[model samples]
Target: MQDCRILITRPEPENTLSRERLHALGLASVPLPMLNIAPIKGPQEQAAIRAQIFDIDQFDYVIFVSKNAARLACDWLDACWPMLPVGVHWIGIGQGTTQTLLEEGVPALSNPGHTTEALLAWLKPAKMTNQKILIVRGAGGRPELGDKLAERGAKVSYLSLYERQKPIYTAQTFFMLPDVHLIWVTSGESLTNLTDYAEQHKPEWKCLPILTPSERVTLQAKEMGWVNARCAQGADDNSLIKATELHIGKQND
Candidate 1:
Protein backbone atom coordinates (compact mmCIF):
# COMPACT_ATOMS: atom_id res chain seq x y z
CA MET A 1 0.00 0.00 0.00
CA GLN A 2 1.21 3.52 -0.67
CA ASP A 3 1.55 5.15 2.74
CA CYS A 4 0.12 8.58 3.35
CA ARG A 5 2.92 11.12 3.47
CA ILE A 6 3.43 12.71 6.91
CA LEU A 7 5.82 15.39 8.05
CA ILE A 8 7.27 15.06 11.58
CA THR A 9 8.27 18.41 13.10
CA ARG A 10 10.20 17.16 16.09
CA PRO A 11 13.97 17.55 16.28
CA GLU A 12 16.19 15.05 14.37
CA PRO A 13 17.69 12.86 17.12
CA GLU A 14 14.58 13.02 19.30
CA ASN A 15 12.09 12.51 16.46
CA THR A 16 12.52 8.71 16.59
CA LEU A 17 9.55 8.02 18.88
CA SER A 18 7.08 9.96 16.75
CA ARG A 19 8.56 8.54 13.54
CA GLU A 20 8.14 4.97 14.80
CA ARG A 21 4.57 5.62 15.89
CA LEU A 22 3.68 7.19 12.53
CA HIS A 23 5.42 4.30 10.74
CA ALA A 24 3.33 1.80 12.70
CA LEU A 25 0.29 3.58 11.31
CA GLY A 26 1.76 2.80 7.85
CA LEU A 27 2.48 6.48 7.16
CA ALA A 28 5.48 7.51 5.12
CA SER A 29 7.00 10.12 7.44
CA VAL A 30 9.59 12.69 6.48
CA PRO A 31 11.50 13.82 9.57
CA LEU A 32 11.43 17.53 9.01
CA PRO A 33 12.89 18.26 12.44
CA MET A 34 12.43 21.82 13.70
CA LEU A 35 14.40 21.98 16.94
CA ASN A 36 17.58 20.63 18.52
CA ILE A 37 18.48 19.90 22.16
CA ALA A 38 21.84 21.08 23.40
CA PRO A 39 23.48 21.72 26.76
CA ILE A 40 23.36 25.18 28.34
CA LYS A 41 26.71 26.83 28.83
CA GLY A 42 28.29 29.09 31.47
CA PRO A 43 29.97 28.39 34.82
CA GLN A 44 26.97 29.43 36.89
CA GLU A 45 24.73 26.58 35.69
CA GLN A 46 27.52 24.02 35.70
CA ALA A 47 28.70 25.06 39.14
CA ALA A 48 25.19 24.82 40.54
CA ILE A 49 24.77 21.31 39.08
CA ARG A 50 28.12 20.32 40.53
CA ALA A 51 27.04 21.54 43.94
CA GLN A 52 23.68 19.79 43.67
CA ILE A 53 25.47 16.51 42.93
CA PHE A 54 26.73 16.14 46.50
CA ASP A 55 23.90 18.14 48.07
CA ILE A 56 21.45 15.57 46.73
CA ASP A 57 20.88 14.34 50.24
CA GLN A 58 19.77 17.80 51.32
CA PHE A 59 16.84 17.82 48.94
CA ASP A 60 13.71 16.15 50.21
CA TYR A 61 12.45 15.56 46.67
CA VAL A 62 13.68 15.46 43.08
CA ILE A 63 11.23 16.08 40.25
CA PHE A 64 11.70 15.46 36.56
CA VAL A 65 9.20 17.37 34.43
CA SER A 66 9.93 15.50 31.18
CA LYS A 67 11.66 12.40 29.84
CA ASN A 68 14.41 14.55 28.35
CA ALA A 69 15.04 16.14 31.74
CA ALA A 70 15.24 12.73 33.36
CA ARG A 71 17.70 11.50 30.72
CA LEU A 72 19.91 14.58 30.91
CA ALA A 73 19.90 14.69 34.71
CA CYS A 74 20.67 10.97 34.85
CA ASP A 75 23.64 11.58 32.56
CA TRP A 76 24.92 14.21 34.96
CA LEU A 77 24.23 12.02 38.01
CA ASP A 78 26.21 9.14 36.52
CA ALA A 79 29.20 11.35 35.86
CA CYS A 80 29.20 13.19 39.20
CA TRP A 81 27.51 10.96 41.73
CA PRO A 82 28.38 7.28 41.62
CA MET A 83 24.88 6.23 42.74
CA LEU A 84 21.51 7.86 43.26
CA PRO A 85 21.29 9.00 46.85
CA VAL A 86 18.72 7.47 49.13
CA GLY A 87 16.16 9.25 51.41
CA VAL A 88 15.37 11.84 48.74
CA HIS A 89 12.00 11.19 47.14
CA TRP A 90 11.77 11.25 43.34
CA ILE A 91 8.74 12.39 41.35
CA GLY A 92 7.97 12.37 37.64
CA ILE A 93 5.28 14.58 36.08
CA GLY A 94 3.82 11.72 34.00
CA GLN A 95 3.99 8.01 33.19
CA GLY A 96 6.66 8.37 30.49
CA THR A 97 8.94 10.29 32.84
CA THR A 98 8.28 7.81 35.63
CA GLN A 99 9.28 4.97 33.32
CA THR A 100 12.52 6.78 32.56
CA LEU A 101 13.27 7.02 36.30
CA LEU A 102 12.40 3.36 36.95
CA GLU A 103 14.73 2.33 34.13
CA GLU A 104 17.50 4.32 35.75
CA GLY A 105 16.94 2.44 39.05
CA VAL A 106 15.26 5.37 40.79
CA PRO A 107 12.24 4.62 42.93
CA ALA A 108 9.91 7.33 41.64
CA LEU A 109 6.50 8.50 42.75
CA SER A 110 4.32 9.75 39.92
CA ASN A 111 0.71 9.90 38.80
CA PRO A 112 -0.20 7.46 36.04
CA GLY A 113 -2.02 10.29 34.24
CA HIS A 114 0.14 12.28 31.84
CA THR A 115 -0.43 15.85 33.00
CA THR A 116 1.13 18.40 35.33
CA GLU A 117 -2.30 19.00 36.83
CA ALA A 118 -2.64 15.33 37.66
CA LEU A 119 0.81 15.29 39.20
CA LEU A 120 -0.06 18.34 41.31
CA ALA A 121 -3.34 16.86 42.54
CA TRP A 122 -1.55 13.67 43.51
CA LEU A 123 1.07 15.61 45.46
CA LYS A 124 -1.40 17.97 47.15
CA PRO A 125 -2.74 15.24 49.41
CA ALA A 126 0.72 14.36 50.62
CA LYS A 127 0.91 17.81 52.35
CA MET A 128 4.67 17.83 52.11
CA THR A 129 5.73 21.08 53.83
CA ASN A 130 9.15 22.65 54.09
CA GLN A 131 10.52 19.99 51.76
CA LYS A 132 13.28 21.06 49.40
CA ILE A 133 12.55 20.10 45.79
CA LEU A 134 15.23 19.81 43.13
CA ILE A 135 13.66 20.23 39.72
CA VAL A 136 15.60 18.98 36.68
CA ARG A 137 14.46 20.63 33.48
CA GLY A 138 15.43 22.50 30.32
CA ALA A 139 16.29 26.20 29.85
CA GLY A 140 12.83 27.11 31.19
CA GLY A 141 9.07 26.58 30.92
CA ARG A 142 5.78 27.31 32.63
CA PRO A 143 6.45 28.11 36.30
CA GLU A 144 3.30 26.38 37.47
CA LEU A 145 5.07 23.24 38.69
CA GLY A 146 7.47 25.09 40.94
CA ASP A 147 4.84 27.61 41.97
CA LYS A 148 2.42 24.91 43.05
CA LEU A 149 5.10 23.09 44.99
CA ALA A 150 6.12 26.31 46.68
CA GLU A 151 2.52 26.98 47.63
CA ARG A 152 2.66 23.67 49.43
CA GLY A 153 5.60 25.07 51.43
CA ALA A 154 8.30 23.36 49.44
CA LYS A 155 11.59 24.99 48.46
CA VAL A 156 12.12 24.40 44.76
CA SER A 157 15.52 24.57 43.11
CA TYR A 158 15.62 24.45 39.33
CA LEU A 159 18.47 22.95 37.29
CA SER A 160 18.87 23.55 33.59
CA LEU A 161 19.91 20.15 32.25
CA TYR A 162 19.74 21.13 28.57
CA GLU A 163 18.46 23.72 26.09
CA ARG A 164 15.96 23.38 23.26
CA GLN A 165 16.78 25.37 20.10
CA LYS A 166 15.15 25.93 16.73
CA PRO A 167 16.66 23.79 13.97
CA ILE A 168 18.30 25.50 10.99
CA TYR A 169 16.17 24.94 7.91
CA THR A 170 17.62 24.10 4.51
CA ALA A 171 16.14 24.58 1.06
CA GLN A 172 15.80 20.80 0.62
CA THR A 173 13.63 20.54 3.69
CA PHE A 174 11.89 23.91 3.68
CA PHE A 175 11.01 24.29 -0.02
CA MET A 176 10.03 20.63 -0.55
CA LEU A 177 6.81 20.81 1.45
CA PRO A 178 3.10 20.86 0.34
CA ASP A 179 3.27 17.15 -0.64
CA VAL A 180 2.86 15.97 2.95
CA HIS A 181 -0.74 15.06 3.81
CA LEU A 182 -0.29 15.60 7.55
CA ILE A 183 2.18 17.11 10.01
CA TRP A 184 2.57 15.74 13.53
CA VAL A 185 3.61 18.30 16.12
CA THR A 186 4.61 16.95 19.54
CA SER A 187 5.58 20.25 21.17
CA GLY A 188 4.47 23.86 20.90
CA GLU A 189 8.05 24.80 20.20
CA SER A 190 8.17 22.49 17.18
CA LEU A 191 4.90 23.94 15.89
CA THR A 192 6.22 27.47 16.24
CA ASN A 193 9.40 26.56 14.40
CA LEU A 194 7.50 24.98 11.49
CA THR A 195 5.07 27.88 11.23
CA ASP A 196 7.95 30.35 11.11
CA TYR A 197 9.79 28.29 8.52
CA ALA A 198 6.73 27.73 6.34
CA GLU A 199 5.73 31.40 6.38
CA GLN A 200 9.21 32.38 5.32
CA HIS A 201 9.39 29.77 2.56
CA LYS A 202 6.02 28.18 1.71
CA PRO A 203 2.98 29.80 3.30
CA GLU A 204 0.53 27.43 1.63
CA TRP A 205 1.78 24.55 3.79
CA LYS A 206 -0.04 26.20 6.71
CA CYS A 207 -3.27 24.71 5.41
CA LEU A 208 -2.19 21.15 6.27
CA PRO A 209 -3.89 19.42 9.16
CA ILE A 210 -1.75 19.12 12.30
CA LEU A 211 -2.08 16.34 14.82
CA THR A 212 -0.76 17.60 18.14
CA PRO A 213 0.03 15.60 21.28
CA SER A 214 -2.03 17.76 23.63
CA GLU A 215 -4.73 20.44 23.69
CA ARG A 216 -2.16 23.01 24.78
CA VAL A 217 -0.16 22.09 21.73
CA THR A 218 -3.24 22.21 19.52
CA LEU A 219 -3.88 25.82 20.53
CA GLN A 220 -0.31 26.65 19.56
CA ALA A 221 -0.83 25.07 16.14
CA LYS A 222 -3.99 27.11 15.60
CA GLU A 223 -2.16 30.28 16.59
CA MET A 224 0.41 29.34 13.97
CA GLY A 225 -2.43 29.29 11.34
CA TRP A 226 -2.94 25.54 11.22
CA VAL A 227 -6.61 26.08 11.96
CA ASN A 228 -7.34 22.40 11.27
CA ALA A 229 -5.29 21.20 14.25
CA ARG A 230 -6.58 18.24 16.23
CA CYS A 231 -5.32 17.23 19.65
CA ALA A 232 -4.82 13.79 21.15
CA GLN A 233 -7.00 13.36 24.23
CA GLY A 234 -3.95 12.05 26.00
CA ALA A 235 -0.17 12.08 25.57
CA ASP A 236 0.67 8.48 24.76
CA ASP A 237 1.26 6.30 21.73
CA ASN A 238 -2.23 4.79 21.92
CA SER A 239 -3.91 8.20 22.23
CA LEU A 240 -1.81 9.61 19.41
CA ILE A 241 -2.72 6.72 17.09
CA LYS A 242 -6.38 7.01 17.99
CA ALA A 243 -6.33 10.75 17.33
CA THR A 244 -4.64 10.22 13.97
CA GLU A 245 -7.12 7.54 12.95
CA LEU A 246 -10.01 9.78 13.94
CA HIS A 247 -8.65 12.68 11.90
CA ILE A 248 -8.01 10.52 8.85
CA GLY A 249 -11.38 8.84 9.24
CA LYS A 250 -13.04 12.24 9.25
CA GLN A 251 -11.15 13.19 6.11
CA ASN A 252 -12.30 10.02 4.38
CA ASP A 253 -15.92 10.77 5.25
Candidate 2:
Protein backbone atom coordinates (compact mmCIF):
# COMPACT_ATOMS: atom_id res chain seq x y z
CA MET A 1 0.00 0.00 0.00
CA GLN A 2 1.17 3.48 -0.77
CA ASP A 3 1.85 5.86 2.08
CA CYS A 4 -1.17 8.04 1.35
CA ARG A 5 -0.42 10.57 4.05
CA ILE A 6 2.21 13.33 3.87
CA LEU A 7 3.26 16.13 6.24
CA ILE A 8 4.71 19.34 4.86
CA THR A 9 7.02 21.14 7.28
CA ARG A 10 7.80 24.33 5.43
CA PRO A 11 6.68 27.96 5.44
CA GLU A 12 3.17 28.96 4.29
CA PRO A 13 3.76 29.62 0.61
CA GLU A 14 5.97 26.59 0.32
CA ASN A 15 3.45 24.45 2.16
CA THR A 16 0.71 25.45 -0.29
CA LEU A 17 3.02 24.78 -3.23
CA SER A 18 3.99 21.35 -1.91
CA ARG A 19 0.39 20.48 -1.16
CA GLU A 20 -0.63 21.33 -4.71
CA ARG A 21 2.09 19.02 -5.96
CA LEU A 22 0.90 16.20 -3.72
CA HIS A 23 -2.65 16.78 -4.86
CA ALA A 24 -1.54 16.55 -8.47
CA LEU A 25 -0.09 13.15 -7.64
CA GLY A 26 -3.39 12.10 -6.00
CA LEU A 27 -1.95 12.02 -2.51
CA ALA A 28 -3.14 13.57 0.72
CA SER A 29 -0.92 16.31 2.17
CA VAL A 30 -1.21 18.16 5.47
CA PRO A 31 0.42 21.51 6.08
CA LEU A 32 2.42 21.45 9.30
CA PRO A 33 4.32 24.63 8.64
CA MET A 34 7.30 25.30 10.87
CA LEU A 35 8.66 28.54 9.42
CA ASN A 36 7.04 31.81 8.37
CA ILE A 37 8.46 34.23 5.82
CA ALA A 38 8.18 37.95 6.53
CA PRO A 39 9.23 40.80 4.35
CA ILE A 40 11.87 43.07 5.89
CA LYS A 41 10.90 46.65 5.42
CA GLY A 42 12.04 49.81 7.11
CA PRO A 43 12.77 53.39 6.21
CA GLN A 44 16.51 52.69 6.36
CA GLU A 45 16.24 49.56 4.18
CA GLN A 46 13.95 51.31 1.70
CA ALA A 47 16.49 54.09 1.45
CA ALA A 48 19.23 51.52 0.93
CA ILE A 49 17.36 49.82 -1.92
CA ARG A 50 16.49 53.15 -3.45
CA ALA A 51 20.09 54.29 -3.31
CA GLN A 52 21.29 51.00 -4.76
CA ILE A 53 18.62 50.79 -7.50
CA PHE A 54 20.40 53.08 -9.92
CA ASP A 55 23.64 51.16 -9.45
CA ILE A 56 22.15 47.88 -10.75
CA ASP A 57 23.47 48.67 -14.20
CA GLN A 58 26.98 48.45 -12.82
CA PHE A 59 26.50 44.79 -12.05
CA ASP A 60 27.23 42.35 -14.87
CA TYR A 61 25.05 39.66 -13.35
CA VAL A 62 22.17 39.39 -10.86
CA ILE A 63 21.13 36.33 -8.87
CA PHE A 64 17.86 35.53 -7.15
CA VAL A 65 17.98 32.87 -4.42
CA SER A 66 14.23 32.43 -4.06
CA LYS A 67 10.85 33.57 -5.42
CA ASN A 68 10.35 35.92 -2.50
CA ALA A 69 13.64 37.57 -3.25
CA ALA A 70 12.86 37.83 -6.92
CA ARG A 71 9.41 39.31 -6.31
CA LEU A 72 10.61 41.87 -3.77
CA ALA A 73 13.55 42.98 -5.90
CA CYS A 74 11.57 43.22 -9.11
CA ASP A 75 8.72 45.08 -7.43
CA TRP A 76 11.12 47.61 -5.99
CA LEU A 77 13.02 47.93 -9.24
CA ASP A 78 9.83 48.57 -11.21
CA ALA A 79 8.86 51.35 -8.84
CA CYS A 80 12.27 53.04 -8.85
CA TRP A 81 14.19 52.00 -11.92
CA PRO A 82 12.03 52.58 -14.99
CA MET A 83 14.39 50.97 -17.49
CA LEU A 84 16.44 47.82 -17.12
CA PRO A 85 19.88 48.18 -18.54
CA VAL A 86 20.98 45.84 -21.28
CA GLY A 87 23.75 43.20 -20.96
CA VAL A 88 23.11 42.55 -17.28
CA HIS A 89 22.59 38.83 -17.02
CA TRP A 90 20.02 37.43 -14.57
CA ILE A 91 20.52 34.05 -12.89
CA GLY A 92 18.14 32.02 -10.78
CA ILE A 93 19.20 29.37 -8.28
CA GLY A 94 16.49 26.83 -9.10
CA GLN A 95 13.42 26.10 -11.22
CA GLY A 96 11.15 27.84 -8.75
CA THR A 97 13.30 30.93 -8.75
CA THR A 98 13.52 30.83 -12.52
CA GLN A 99 9.74 30.60 -12.78
CA THR A 100 9.44 33.52 -10.42
CA LEU A 101 11.65 35.66 -12.62
CA LEU A 102 9.75 34.61 -15.70
CA GLU A 103 6.46 35.49 -14.03
CA GLU A 104 7.80 38.94 -13.22
CA GLY A 105 8.96 39.38 -16.87
CA VAL A 106 12.63 39.37 -15.86
CA PRO A 107 14.49 37.24 -18.35
CA ALA A 108 17.39 35.35 -16.80
CA LEU A 109 20.55 34.18 -18.57
CA SER A 110 20.98 30.76 -16.98
CA ASN A 111 18.65 28.29 -15.25
CA PRO A 112 21.11 25.70 -14.06
CA GLY A 113 20.68 22.84 -11.60
CA HIS A 114 19.27 23.98 -8.26
CA THR A 115 21.57 24.85 -5.32
CA THR A 116 24.66 27.00 -4.88
CA GLU A 117 27.07 24.26 -5.97
CA ALA A 118 25.32 23.71 -9.28
CA LEU A 119 24.95 27.43 -9.93
CA LEU A 120 28.64 27.98 -9.17
CA ALA A 121 29.60 24.99 -11.28
CA TRP A 122 27.71 26.49 -14.22
CA LEU A 123 29.57 29.78 -13.73
CA LYS A 124 33.03 28.24 -13.32
CA PRO A 125 33.55 27.76 -17.05
CA ALA A 126 32.43 31.27 -17.86
CA LYS A 127 34.37 34.51 -17.71
CA MET A 128 33.97 35.68 -14.09
CA THR A 129 36.97 37.95 -13.65
CA ASN A 130 35.93 41.50 -12.78
CA GLN A 131 32.25 40.68 -13.17
CA LYS A 132 29.77 42.30 -10.78
CA ILE A 133 27.11 40.05 -9.24
CA LEU A 134 24.03 41.26 -7.36
CA ILE A 135 22.35 38.71 -5.11
CA VAL A 136 18.75 39.20 -3.92
CA ARG A 137 17.79 36.96 -1.03
CA GLY A 138 16.66 36.67 2.57
CA ALA A 139 18.75 37.30 5.63
CA GLY A 140 20.80 34.52 7.32
CA GLY A 141 21.13 32.48 4.10
CA ARG A 142 24.30 30.67 3.14
CA PRO A 143 26.95 32.99 1.70
CA GLU A 144 28.25 30.20 -0.49
CA LEU A 145 26.93 31.75 -3.69
CA GLY A 146 28.43 35.18 -3.07
CA ASP A 147 31.68 33.74 -1.67
CA LYS A 148 32.10 31.40 -4.63
CA LEU A 149 31.34 34.14 -7.13
CA ALA A 150 33.84 36.43 -5.43
CA GLU A 151 36.49 33.71 -5.43
CA ARG A 152 35.85 33.32 -9.16
CA GLY A 153 36.75 37.01 -9.57
CA ALA A 154 33.27 38.45 -9.44
CA LYS A 155 32.37 41.33 -7.14
CA VAL A 156 29.24 40.32 -5.26
CA SER A 157 26.59 42.56 -3.71
CA TYR A 158 23.94 41.10 -1.46
CA LEU A 159 20.44 42.54 -0.90
CA SER A 160 18.37 41.26 1.97
CA LEU A 161 14.64 41.48 1.18
CA TYR A 162 13.01 39.30 3.83
CA GLU A 163 13.51 37.10 6.88
CA ARG A 164 12.42 33.59 7.79
CA GLN A 165 11.04 33.23 11.28
CA LYS A 166 10.05 30.15 13.27
CA PRO A 167 6.31 30.04 13.59
CA ILE A 168 4.82 30.56 17.02
CA TYR A 169 2.48 27.63 17.27
CA THR A 170 -1.12 28.49 18.08
CA ALA A 171 -3.79 25.97 19.02
CA GLN A 172 -4.86 25.83 15.40
CA THR A 173 -1.33 25.29 14.19
CA PHE A 174 -0.85 22.56 16.80
CA PHE A 175 -4.05 20.90 15.69
CA MET A 176 -2.76 20.84 12.12
CA LEU A 177 0.16 18.57 13.05
CA PRO A 178 -0.22 15.32 14.91
CA ASP A 179 0.51 11.72 14.06
CA VAL A 180 1.63 11.34 10.45
CA HIS A 181 3.62 8.98 8.29
CA LEU A 182 6.18 11.40 6.84
CA ILE A 183 7.37 15.02 6.93
CA TRP A 184 8.96 16.79 3.96
CA VAL A 185 11.61 19.31 4.93
CA THR A 186 12.90 21.66 2.21
CA SER A 187 15.28 23.83 4.22
CA GLY A 188 17.51 23.67 7.29
CA GLU A 189 15.47 26.33 9.06
CA SER A 190 12.25 24.42 8.62
CA LEU A 191 13.90 21.25 9.89
CA THR A 192 15.24 23.10 12.92
CA ASN A 193 11.79 24.44 13.73
CA LEU A 194 10.35 20.97 13.37
CA THR A 195 12.97 19.57 15.71
CA ASP A 196 12.17 22.18 18.29
CA TYR A 197 8.51 21.23 18.14
CA ALA A 198 9.32 17.53 18.22
CA GLU A 199 11.40 17.99 21.34
CA GLN A 200 8.33 19.20 23.19
CA HIS A 201 6.17 16.38 21.87
CA LYS A 202 8.49 13.64 20.72
CA PRO A 203 5.79 11.06 20.34
CA GLU A 204 4.09 13.15 17.67
CA TRP A 205 7.01 12.60 15.28
CA LYS A 206 9.02 9.69 16.68
CA CYS A 207 8.21 7.17 13.96
CA LEU A 208 7.60 9.53 11.05
CA PRO A 209 10.05 9.51 8.18
CA ILE A 210 11.75 12.81 7.44
CA LEU A 211 12.30 13.53 3.75
CA THR A 212 14.68 16.33 2.83
CA PRO A 213 15.43 18.16 -0.40
CA SER A 214 19.19 17.60 -0.16
CA GLU A 215 21.93 15.81 1.76
CA ARG A 216 22.56 18.84 3.93
CA VAL A 217 18.95 18.92 5.09
CA THR A 218 19.10 15.14 5.71
CA LEU A 219 22.13 15.56 7.96
CA GLN A 220 20.29 18.25 9.87
CA ALA A 221 17.22 16.03 10.31
CA LYS A 222 19.39 13.19 11.52
CA GLU A 223 21.03 15.44 14.05
CA MET A 224 17.55 16.36 15.25
CA GLY A 225 16.66 12.75 16.17
CA TRP A 226 15.14 11.64 12.92
CA VAL A 227 16.81 8.32 12.24
CA ASN A 228 14.67 7.59 9.19
CA ALA A 229 15.67 10.68 7.29
CA ARG A 230 16.73 10.59 3.65
CA CYS A 231 17.65 13.17 1.04
CA ALA A 232 16.07 13.42 -2.39
CA GLN A 233 18.42 14.28 -5.23
CA GLY A 234 16.16 16.81 -6.89
CA ALA A 235 14.44 19.48 -4.84
CA ASP A 236 11.44 19.61 -7.17
CA ASP A 237 8.03 18.34 -6.13
CA ASN A 238 8.02 15.36 -8.48
CA SER A 239 11.48 14.32 -7.34
CA LEU A 240 10.47 14.61 -3.70
CA ILE A 241 7.39 12.45 -4.23
CA LYS A 242 9.37 9.82 -6.11
CA ALA A 243 12.02 9.75 -3.42
CA THR A 244 9.41 9.30 -0.71
CA GLU A 245 7.74 6.50 -2.64
CA LEU A 246 11.02 4.72 -3.14
CA HIS A 247 11.91 5.07 0.53
CA ILE A 248 8.56 3.68 1.55
CA GLY A 249 9.01 0.86 -0.95
CA LYS A 250 12.35 0.04 0.59
CA GLN A 251 10.78 -0.22 4.02
CA ASN A 252 8.21 -2.65 2.69
CA ASP A 253 10.85 -4.73 0.95
Q: Which one wins on TM-score?
A: 2
Q: Which run of 10 residues does model 1 get worst, by summed lDDT?
A: 1-10
Q: Model 2, which residues run further than 4 Å from truth? A: 1-3, 109-111, 170-178, 203-206, 248-253
| Candidate 2: tens digits of C-alpha lDDT, residues 50-83 | 7777788888888988777888888988987777
In TM-score terms, candidate 1 sits at: 0.86
List candidate 1 segments past 4 Å from native.
Answer: 41-44, 234-236
Per-model TM against the reference:
0.86, 0.89
Give the range where candidate 2 is weakest over 10 consecutive residues by summed lDDT: 170-179
Q: Could you give candidate 1's per-residue lDDT for residues 1-253 as a string of tens digits?
A: 1346777776645478867877766777778887788876678878887787768778988989778888877777888778778888888877667878889878888875667777787776456688889888888766888898888888888887788888887777666654787777777777788888888887877887778876777887787788788887555556666777777777778
Candidate 2: C-alpha lDDT: 0.78
